[model samples]
Target: MTNWYKSWEEFHTSLSKHQNQTHQLFRLRSSTSVSQRNKQEVHVYAWMTSQESGQGPANDFVQQVDTTRGSISRFGTKNVGTHNHSLGRRQFDNHPSNRRIDEPGLVELVRDLSSACSKAKLIMQHLRLKSGQYAQKQSLYVYAPIIAHTQSYLILGKQATLRDVHNLVAKLKAMRNGSASVEERLKARLREFCTQSGNTATVFIDDAKTAQTITLQSQQMRRFFKAFPEVMLVDATHNTNDAMFKLFSFMVHDVYRHGQYVQHSLMENESEECLRDAISAFKEFNPTWEETKVIIIGKDFGELALLEREFSQAKSFVPFSCKKKYLRTEMTKREYGGTNSLNTKRAEDSIDMMLKATTLDEYTIGLKCLFYLLDNVKLRAEDPVPHPKHTFLQYFMRNWGSCRQLWAAFGRAGIPHLGNNRRARDFMGYLKDILKSTMGLDECVDTLIFLQSVLRT
Candidate 1:
């Protein structure tokens, strides 16, 4: 008996020899036969030779085993029958011979199972590829549309950034060539694809001259006043050069809905004609001037007569005494050297402080200064004889004098007025905060909605 275990090399050598050899047979017989009634039977047989049998060596040997065993004692016949049965069973289990017994069905089953596993693997691979491609495609789709629709222009004679365009082209190239070389043939193919897809290969350069002309035309002074029918606040400050004219603008409270229209033009001289022209231009822009209302808020009566003549059909000319209105009312009454005296220097100083108050902290400091000035004014007003030399100091003592009366006058007429710089600054600060915190257009809309809700409440 040989050991069943062998190394792969040793097993291969043994298997190779077994395949080349003719068929091998072994026989076994029982010790007793039923016919002889417990008598032992001995059987002798000779296997046939291939040359004499005229059959192949392997077939002759197999047939000889069957004949010899079958002709022996009954015990030998039984042994031969069992061997024959095993041989027939093997005919359905082994290779070519087993192929006859629904072999195609077995082959197909194996092929089908292999095919199913292969298809499943392929599907998983395809899904992974598609997921990656989809992400890439999505990014390209988003940015490409923006680039295609982007309005390009040159500023200071320099071209605008083309980073988006370059990025798009790079992404398109990457999509076409995953791991392949970027050959001329591939480029030609890409060009053809772009053309078919309505994507132009040429980059159109924006004309600087044309862009400038368009921008100027777009920015031309147009009638935005119709949309906001309220008092226009007119004030002027000379710039460092003092050559060119620039007017500072502010809208009165009612100007947002309906009120007086005010305008300013910085002339070499504060002439009546310059004022008239400014008022005329304003009225021209306000075509509904016949239907609409007008109120002019000026620092003084500088252009009052001209405005009245220009807008004769409109309401009364309301003179806004910045000194009396803002300085006195906003600064506690005691600050203006008593409510009786209107001092110019103190008013100027208060206005300067208000202008300097840029931040919230600075604004609080200015208010504190105003409080101190108001207290000083009250002390002076109580004096038996107010010091004439303290005229500069007395202006601060008056607390803006009759400015409060002006505010009341407008208020009675259902007109809105931002009485002082502090109030204007506060409103501006609120607007700034709203703009800074807003995320985007949607957020801005949400903020407006929230404001509307708050107003309703």
Candidate 2:
């Protein structure tokens, strides 16, 4: 029967009395602590077995007291075995099959493996391999004692599983990164670059609102800018780091006719002020920046206006391919043909002809053809709801038509773009090859500089 004791001492006194009277042994199974009325109480469990019995041992006597409700419970167990619950017995008398490493070096090996984020099974295999025990049966066998030791070494206070190792690695990585602020880390990396390359790169650190920007241009880049400043390409990449900052690159064609990055800026956004600051850095470092004659870019309108204001002499050229992609996206909008594939293709083909026109006369004819096709478009009986073709026509007129001379082929006929205006697009693929999606700004800067050094040589 279960009884509630006022203290742990009282419970032990009563338990000893039962053991002496019945000549029984108690093996502690486990214990659980509960808080009741702002006070902590523990419930201890022990299974009883008779040492020398005339009748069978009372294995069915189970008592559990719920301290919260001040209630008692009793249950029966069918099996009971002799168990030595003494701490000394547990320390010396383990199963013969259980493995333990007594060598100091081997024990430290387990700790090293665990610290290196090895899984329990893998660590066991490595240990077994070192001991020349390569049996297939031991492949999945994990030594519990080594794992317990590893847990202690890692300060985990419990058995170390695969997830625990992963958490440890993640914690260490976070601690390493947290040792310095973002700005400090970036400045250190820049300093390392300067020490190695012997080039005093331009850097801008803004501590206001955490929208700090860094513009990098080495001395070699300055020489390239002065010699080959006829063509320039500017583009920005997103999701480069956790801060959501955009990386903008200003490139120029080197003497070898290869697109080489002259300047790179990591900014908080594409705001005009940030762009102006980056451009000003460029103009400050390389005096021949105004000598740039042709600037090729994607469809960043804000960048276009800023570039126009800063480098008015340079002709801003957007590739026809970029315009085609944008126009095709607009064609799929609801006000246009929506999901009507046939109408979309027809509109796209006519627009492609207009954009591919070599002269103003050919452009006009292609435009008339587009208008004619839009006017004559008919909806199929099985098709979904049709949209007004005039919507796309109006959109083109309002957005692209007003700036036809900027993106159209006829207007860019005489401009020298080194046979293409997609230099920025080509460089994007190279950047993606060297950069990962999860790199921080400091790592990104280091990687870019390392690769640039390799390319510069």
Candidate 3:
């Protein structure tokens, strides 16, 4: 009865004013029952306030209170002990055994491993070094940081030192050739230098055949228009070897868009068929080429006629004629006292002058020099002076006789000879200035630009 009342709050409340003290007795009964079950505490209060207010039937209320009292007694006596045993069984499964590394420890371990790896790499490199290997090895391993520093100096138009290269090589050795290390370092260095200094490094590769193949595949004459669309300059020169003359057509390209000649090619020999073949080669490269786009053809009078017949739609500008007139003037100036005949000493003097002038200017100085030499020979012939077996006129005529035709062609094209001796001297001085200002691989491009700019001015 005490257990029944202990779980039944409605029964105590239904007792009215006498039930207040009975409710206190029910609480004492709940404490005693909880202690007898498992030494655990349990609270027994009104489950529903409406039931306590006598709103339901008494019999139904009493039955509900009895069922709840049985459920509480069974749970406290059986379920609570079973739940504690089950929690003990799952203790290992609920929690992990091993403790993970903290963030600071993991970071330190990584740093230590990296350091050890670097030291190992250095030791391996030291082991590999031998007295014999240094003499045979030509390939170098350049580093990124060192190359970067070298490029910085290069960008400021300064040359990289041997110390810079040595430092880079040392870094590369330390890296143990990590991820694309060599290629990445080279590419980065090239990109920085090429972008800032406009210089290209000439890397010598093992494949000579591949280099030749690339040159042939990249045929400048055939791909002239595609490579340089703006302005194309075409000219032809004749060369004599073993007293036989061979004509060579050439085309100049302005690739940098800086109004400077970048590339050249030998088109064909001196014949109508060869000229036609040259035209065909050009057409093969650019099928859409029209007569108007042909622009200019700077050639000799003989080739001029053939060029006109072949490319009638194109306009031809002759700069070599002025060159020839200049040469003839110089020749006449040398012929004041003597006739067209040249003496032995005079011929030798003339040859020396021609060779000297040839190195001074590109077109004019050469033509004028050759003209003066030839005129000196003509003066000696009129005088009829007997000379040795090896005469200047005879030597020049035998070896480089065809060069006269080259000069005449230059003159016919209206290209002035490097003017007078004073002008030639000035041009040489300009060339010397360029040579002085330019250094390293950049000299090639700089010299070309200097020449073009001088000509334009």
Candidate 4:
């Protein structure tokens, strides 16, 4: 319920009631409280409970908080007592569903959902659109009813509120994903999908065993996996599905210069064995999987080392981001003037900025500037010219200088994307939204195939 204030003084007085409260999030805005307040006021958006924000009874919540003596915490007790008793429980509008079009919540819903629907992912979470019909709005009327039922409002007309749209989407997902047991529903869907899509998907599930893995690959992915087996990015993301299994993404770029997700695997963990089994399955899907030489890039050497064995000709590269981090860290040593002049922070920033340079000319200019700073510091002290023996330059040269081709933009042969955990992390945020990625085995399949479908178009 939203509480309102007539003037700043009133609002301040009410807020002061929670003076000793901490870590409570608050959002305030000017709202037309129409059917509720029908007066000029500021509103506090909150679910009414024992405490203003459900923090609980405060030890020292008075205007003049006394912490010296062991003061009894009676602050939230008043709210708690008030919350428990039904006397004047009208704090919540029992029949708020009868509110008019000008109601505060409905108004807020309309305002927020309009902006949210502009984004495809958000709209998908909030709407009930079927596959291939994501863009089509055949029955806006159907979505409106979802709002009416959830909010207890009789939606009379064609005009739909943002709240209605979002609720409808949620309702649709609950239905489409179905209420079948996680395993049974998933197995059925997997069977139907494999039959329909002409794609290859594999699942490993065992009640007796602790961990499971599911892998999905499309026809486009199959072709790319077989033809140009070069440059695969391997990374795992967590918490995108219902189960807490790690969602590992195997990515490669196709001839068309687009970043393609060739395989999606859900594993119990990122263990070397799990990864090895997952990668080996690529060959199972197509015997010619490792027919061509491959280049594998990843953050984990444990996994990459195993790939070396499977594909002998496969070259391994570290993500450029990881290499940059290592350089930045190594320079932050005490000998490098940790926080003294020629500081590590500045050195690290310079190196990072220089590495991101896309062209050789830009990189050369950046390198010149970097050496000028490092060299100047050395000459100013008349210190023996910097050498590889003790300085960061030595470690850098030995570890990464010669390998610039593996991490620098100019060195990449038109490869547009690097396989990094960041990409998977970002996608997980969008996939999970407020719900888990997969609820069961079937839900896991649905989630991966949905991702594959999105990537396809």
Q: Which regions of candidate 2 deviate over 4 angstroms?
A: 1-169, 175-178, 195-198, 205-211, 339-342, 377-389, 419-421
Top TM-score prediction, candidate number: 2
Residue 361 alpha-carbon offset, candidate 1, angstroms = 38
Q: What lDDT does the true structure give each of the candidates?
A: 0.37, 0.68, 0.36, 0.58
Q: Please give the lDDT score for candidate 2.
A: 0.68
Q: All candidates' TM-scores?
A: 0.26, 0.61, 0.24, 0.51
What is the full ranking by lDDT, best candidate first? 2, 4, 1, 3
Per-residue lDDT tens digits for candidate 4, residues 116-146, read 3244344434332231132133333222332
Whichever of 1 and 3 has more TM-score, that candidate is: 1
Candidate 3 on 312-364: residue-level lDDT in tens?
Answer: 65444433343434334443443332335444355444444443343323333
TM-score of 3: 0.24
Runs in model 1 deviating more than 4 A are 1-221, 240-266, 291-301, 313-321, 324-407, 410-412, 416-457
Q: Is candidate 1 or 2 superior in lDDT? A: 2
